[model samples]
Target: MKLDESLFTVPGVRRGLRFYVTGPTPCPYLPDQFERKAFTHLSQAAPDALHHQLSEAGFRRSQSVAYRPACPNCNACRSVRVDAQSFSPSRNQLRVLSRNSDLIRRPVEPRATREQYRLLKHYLVNRHEGGGMSDMGFREYAGMVNETPVQTALFEYRQGPEEDSPLVAVSLTDILRDGFSMVYTFFDTRQPKRSLGTYMILDHIRNAESYGLPHVYLGYWIKQSPKMAYKKRFQPLEVLDGPVWRRLEEDE
Candidate 1:
């Protein structure tokens, strides 16, 4: 395992390099243990290549964000992606996709708004109250939505252009040279019928195809977590196993 020495010269606040290790901390996905990460600056010189390689190897990019596991013994986090060329929505997925047809998606600068924050707050309280981000305040939310170095945008989902207060969902996505990475998404869970989560991914897949990109990098998929199982529904998918992304048979 060779660390890319080039990573040292990667872009960002160039006030000389500094590296530090985290104390053993509980793993987010798995119970009762710790996780650590070795991070570096994300440079524009070779962002696409670096992002592709790092993401393929289980790293997740936040806003200009890039991070990977450096834990002592844990290896549960695995990167996942949807094969845009081969993806075929199931009957249920198609239904969800169709349900969202009334919504208009607009690509806007990646900045937080009052309405968006309101939806995010609702989502957190209803869906993730006991989770870590449950209490994120305005400034924190701003950083999550605003800080970045790569090409990123916010997809606003509204019912109709003329309808006031129509915003129903929002997604933060990175427009990579090769494909797109869905950084985060939050929606009005009150409108569960729309299945906003599924809708966003489907939209990204369609967006990828329009750009001639071949894959949509989904952050991770853990078999045991019901939260992540939905990812498998987007069939003709690939999971990062070791150093390669092995394509799984539809039934496998």
Candidate 2:
């Protein structure tokens, strides 16, 4: 398939890109299922424009690769993003904001640090014991944070505004031309009551609004995946349905 250049205000449309599909792997978020991905490397002269177009096309970036689910028989993995301009927090969500009000958000460079790596290990051990990234080491962690080809930002959430405040959470995000894609986030599990995960998502929406961006890409959400159901809490969401994006209905 070829990308339509008529739909953009940007030039340097990439051409002749190659895409491949991986062999089926056990579905991580669902049971008795398998998954595949149609992916292409983020190799081009204009990486930012290419990244933006692919993201609008429902592809997500990992390192230098852009991919989306291509499970031939199953399309449960739907790409979803929040309409940052129209998002309004629920009562519970507001409480989450209040709880983390003391946490200061600091945007840092993409380079990784030992402090962040140690925090990642603690988060993984408590929250995702046997998941795919449970065994990730510092080297791999650094690569994940630093090997990006496009613009990226790492938000360090601390207990205070001071540079030396206790770090409690970290969000590695992709800054697309039109919005921010939350690539990954990890936090202090010891303060679960702070609802750090929910707080981060809310903060991203707030961040998008402040930047005058339209959306906060939240990656894929599956109706049957309990792990992803929380994404629905963010209203005014748009989901990529095939080649079109439309407002997600309440019943959907």
Residue pairs in clash, model 2: none
lDDT of 1 by residue, 104-193 (tens): 988889888878898999999999997989998988889988887777889898988763648999999887766888989999999988
In order, candidate lDDTs are: 0.77, 0.89
TM-score of each: 0.86, 0.94
- Cα error, residue 114 of model 1, in Å, equals 1.4
Candidate 2 lDDT score relative to the true structure: 0.89
**Model 1 pairs in collision:** 25-34
- For model 2, the superposed segments whose C-alpha errors exceed 4 Å read 1-13
In TM-score terms, candidate 1 sits at 0.86
